[model samples]
Target: MAVQALKDYKFSPADAQEKFHGAQLLYVGWDEHLMFCAPFAYCLPPNTLFSDLCQKFMAHSFGYHPDWKSVDFSKVTWLKSGQPWQPDMSKTLAELGLKHKDVLRFQTPGLKGINGTCS
Candidate 1:
């Protein structure tokens, strides 16, 4: 469906990349983990390494979960902006082609939330 505007509605997006000082907005979600309810957003530099993202940021964000420690990054599947993506852990976000407002989702093959209830 197309948006029906009463007038020429045009303005800069409030969450545009320029709004963030040297950082880009990125969203990350853990598949089947309803415990988080939704993806977490972060304002980070494009040069942030993928390894740091998993070991630092992600660890800080989802470490409290019972399944967190069991998750193996090597076995985890990834999706970038809703499409399958194979990322190099040593590469930076920019090197992986991630851009502002990109959504990254990961699934731990055997670890679905507690009891597989998705939470």
Candidate 2:
């Protein structure tokens, strides 16, 4: 049922595997007194099917309080993407230099050496 609702959702991704392949629940809203669904579901996307299961679990889990009127589901956010991991300049350059001793010109072959190095 919840899965169907997710599919019907506008922002929800179609074909969970493709769009939400690496989708992860960054943080599940926690209910202090344990009012609803434990308010927590931090889990790694093991597989595509697991992703769907997770979505199903998150969509509708009002546990003890199953009130459609009193419940506030305004904070259920699917944090699929995370902070961009910036490459360490020093490490990256060092690795690159070590990996490829010959740094080919990014441009075309004819312009290999536009300077005096060209034969």
Best by lDDT: 1
- Residue 52 alpha-carbon offset, candidate 2, angstroms: 13
Worst 10 residues of 1 by lDDT: 1-10
Candidate maximizing TM-score: 1
TM-score of each: 0.92, 0.23
TM-score of 2: 0.23
lDDT of 1 by residue, 56-98 (tens): 9999999999999999998999998788999999999999888
Per-residue lDDT of 20-68 in model 2, one digit per residue for the tens? 4454333344222233333454333433242333345544542333332
Relative to the true structure, how large is the alpha-carbon lDDT of every model? Answer: 0.93, 0.32
| Clash count list over all predictions | 0, 1
Show model 2 residue runs off by greater than 4 Å. 1-20, 35-37, 42-59, 72-119
Error of 1 at 45 (Å): 0.5
> Per-residue error at 30 for model 2, in Å?
3.9
